[model samples]
Target: MDITRRRLLVLLPAAAVAWEFVRAGTPESAPNYKTSEHWWGMLIDITECIGCGSCVRACAQENDVPDGYYRTWIERYHVTDYAIERPQVESPNGGKEGFPMNEDSSGKNFFVPKLCNHCADSPCTQVCPVGATFVSPDGVVLVDKNYCLGCRYCVQACPYGCRFINPKTNTADKCSLCYHRITKGLTTACAEVCPTGARQLADLKNPKDPIHEYLRTHSVQILKPHMATGAKVFYNGMDGSVR
Candidate 1:
């Protein structure tokens, strides 16, 4: 109430200095996020998947995907005797819950988790007339919702049926390999929640990543190699019947 000009000036500078200190003490939003430094990919170990659908549930909760649509899902493949080529695939509700018991025990049953391959030469990106869909420098395929025309060109171009039109945004949507989380140094939702360690987030650009060793020792393959999309999601112990 009795402050002079001199007191006001001195207090103002001190308050400014205190504010700067507080800002410095706060955790940085990002210390050093370099998108170009990491090339992202995923590794799904088919043998390890138990059809529990934990990954599917986690992804749905993390992404807030609409009902009946999935950024990631699990398919239960039933290969009957001598019917390896035409395995019966079923994913009710995108496998959000663990599947019912298979009554037909005559055949071998396995679960395959599916998601955006995030191809290096992505057809979805190529067919987008507005360039809304793009592969990041780190190899994650992402869609700019604001820039998308909602024409569904990218949806049609995708061979794996990964891309879908978001009901809310009316724009192309798919897995960014959890780019928001990964860029902040966290694993994808699916990978993090997997109880069997079946799902793994990989950085191909990092030679030290366990994916390299897994590839070296296991017979890994990409879905639809003939599509030549340079798919980064690698499957270990994948059956031939998977499409």
Candidate 2:
């Protein structure tokens, strides 16, 4: 059998993991989904984001995200006209209720949403002692909540600050790209609720997806490129001041 890299991560045999999934109540079917045929990512149009918090609210409701912690959040950036000034950033309560009025008149403000980059070379996966964190076949970095050790190694290893210890589950948690929904051919909650369509669920392997056309003709960048983590979240119309 041609097993995927993700399936091989668990110490137990493939059949055993499948059984565990069944035990954990994960759905057994995805309606003809083939992970190898899809590569998941996100395209963020920073210019179109209105900081409305619709995405944040939808993700919380959809995933049951705990308060004060965020799987996906937005940051407001105040980039001044002055060339050397650093951008002022804020995300009060993970920006779930929209942002406060910007008082700085000398600068322009924009919103940047942040989430798990789902890096192909994710350091979180490398740091997991129990193989609980792994990259899925479709390129999304995910945690095996049932198997997590609660050691917090993966959380500490993540450069993007995406992972956190789920107080409810006592395991590492972050965005899974809405795996349950996407496997059934549905968009992520954040993407679906984005009022301006600024955030889009992208399938890099699908040639017909608009992401390919956008990437070919527009300037896009991954966060902290010097780390070389192979982050999949691509940002467009981003200012250099954004971290």
Candidate 3:
């Protein structure tokens, strides 16, 4: 073994033990108390959406999402007889005012909310070499930045392409379903600020929640349901072609 490198390696075990003891005393070690059975999800009503971008702004403001990065976004689609096209996708700064016009002769238009779906069998978690990316007991997918090696594997494995590597933190980041806020008994910023209630969050496991009610009453679809990751996000009145 190289002498210099070998000496450094020998000290690493002692350093790791000291680091763990220090971290254990910090506030971050606070117990993660919870009572939920599974991860909750939202049902977005596309028909009710006016292409308003309120959720986008709320998410940025609430999470301090970096410039050119989005934890949540809206996509506008114009469907026509000849073809379907996306007119506007992301306007990070503007809220409801950022909605784009269809400008198509077909006059068919709608908006869809896009975010991390927190799949039960998430490809992101599977590809993470370190245990940084993991599914919570309640089914929420999360990234422990402290453990993340910043390999960007989770970013590439995401089918929704929702994950992004944060330049500031040098770690993979994505929607946490507002894990910090939700755990505090507050609604997600996107759901809380959504005008017209187009986007709503609730527990799918709880049949009493409005999301479950909507699922029972309407034909809902998940993005790429055929992938069978058991995505919890539901889309109401979504065009089959969009999937």
Alpha carbon lDDT of each predicted model: 0.90, 0.91, 0.78
- lDDT of candidate 2? 0.91
Off by over 4 Å in 3: 1-38, 84-97, 105-107
Candidate 3 C-alpha lDDT tens digits along 72-102? 8877665665555434343434333576444
**Model 1 stretches astray by more than 4 angstroms:** 1-28
Where does model 2 exceed 4 Å of error?
1-30, 83-85
- For residue 37, model 1's alpha carbon misses the true position, in angstroms, by 1.0
Which digits, one per residue and each the tens of the lDDT, describe model 1 over residues 1-243?
Answer: 899999999999999999987665543553466787899999999999998888888888898888888999999999998988889999988888889988896877899999999999998899888788899888999999999999999889999999899999988889878888997778999999999999999998888999999999999999999989999999999988899
Sorted on TM-score, best first, the list reads: 1, 2, 3
lDDT of 3 at 63: 78
Whole-structure CA lDDT of model 3: 0.78
**What is the number of backbone collisions in each predicted candidate, taken in the order shown?**
0, 0, 1
Candidate with best TM-score:
1
Model 1 compared with the native: what TM-score? 0.88
Score every model by TM-score: 0.88, 0.86, 0.80
Q: Which one is best on lDDT?
A: 2
